[model samples]
Target: MLMFATNDQLLKNAIDDLGKYVDLKDLGEPRYILGIQVNHDKKEQKIKREQKITLNQRKQIDDILKTFHMEDCKAVKTPMDVSQWKQSLARATESKQATNCPDVPYQSLMGHLMYLVQGTRPDIAFATNYRLWW
Candidate 1:
């Protein structure tokens, strides 16, 4: 877990207070957590530093794509195939039970996309939302 405060004193106080109820060992600053990267160090200068946090999920995104066998896919403006989607929608209206392709890992892909949107992929929110429809 990560905690934040407006200043060092407040952060320390919060940690100390929490320590009273439970045993706590400060792990210093977090270098990375989950798929997010935390960067605040300067390699050139070792003496002075600034308190700036930079977070990114490039590695996480790559891992997710590779896991879903999409790492080799070419980038496109559309999130999904519009023609196939339309056909699916049309078939849905024709029959009460919409039988989607069993080969497609729709649920798994949606779950991962949801996690990304909730964590670090605001850019894909619209695409994910649109994909949620029948």
Candidate 2:
């Protein structure tokens, strides 16, 4: 679960204090947890990096869905046109402008799609990353 604390000291103290109630001995300090990574660098302030997904990460998917905005979009068994979709770096490059062709909502949808790819949807990684190229 994502957690937010008022300050660094509070977070540190919490982690230290958690040792008393939760045994984290079985888990390693996560290098990458969920779509975010926890890193420590004395030289830099803490930053949350999105390990997967990129800008315009799923424009095609969202653009298509948006066209059906008023229509019902039930969760489907698949995320894309599985039978016809093919991964092509060249195609993605050529289609970059088209993918980035929309506005704020499309952009937001792209971000959400990227988060989805980072979370539990590994199957969409290729397509999502492909979208990133665009």
Candidate 3:
């Protein structure tokens, strides 16, 4: 669907001109497009677009948590825990078994987190990118 913002007269004229070349159906003002919510204020002559996760994105995160058995995990106040990272790094360097650790779905979870970071969660991008390095 095509959506354009303009004055009433101009929109009518454009629609009339385009109707000659192609069929057109007015779906009226759009409240949502793609994954973004659209808010229009006619009195202020302003429009705002907000990015929000759809039902599919919610299900994706839910599935990821379920796969890892982390559905009931407690939420942390911060995205990155520096103390935990330090302990993990220390353990990795001291233990030979760290080199032979089993494979994990880190790449898949990173991909999902990256999508969230690129969309509406810029706050987690730094932590996500830091994890990518290791």
Q: Candidate 2's error at 29, in angstroms? A: 23
Give the residue spans of candidate 3 off by over 4 A.
1-57, 79-88, 95-99
Ranking by lDDT: 1, 3, 2
TM-score of candidate 3 relative to the true fold: 0.53
Candidate 2: the clashing residue pairs are none
Which of 1 and 3 is the better model by TM-score? 1
Number of backbone-clashing residue pairs for each candidate, in the order shown:
0, 0, 0
For model 2, the stretches where C-alpha displacement exceeds 4 angstroms are 1-100
Order the candidate numbers by TM-score, best to worst: 1, 3, 2
Cα-lDDT of candidate 2: 0.55
Per-residue lDDT for 1-134 in model 3, tens only?
Answer: 66453456776888899999999989877665544345555645443332232222455557768987799999654467888767866776677443465576677778878876776567778777877765
Tell me how many residue pairs clash in candidate 3. Answer: 0
Best by lDDT: 1
lDDT agreement with native, every candidate = 0.75, 0.55, 0.66
Tell me the tens digit of each residue's lDDT in model 2 across 23-100.
Answer: 645343344554344554533442443122223324445655666472467763445564545644455567775657
The TM-score leader among the candidates is 1
lDDT measured at residue 96 in model 2 versus the true structure, 0 to 100:
72
Positional deviation of residue 104's Cα in model 3 after best superposition, in angstroms: 1.3
When summed lDDT is taken over every stretch of 10 residues in candidate 2, the lowest stretch is 48-57
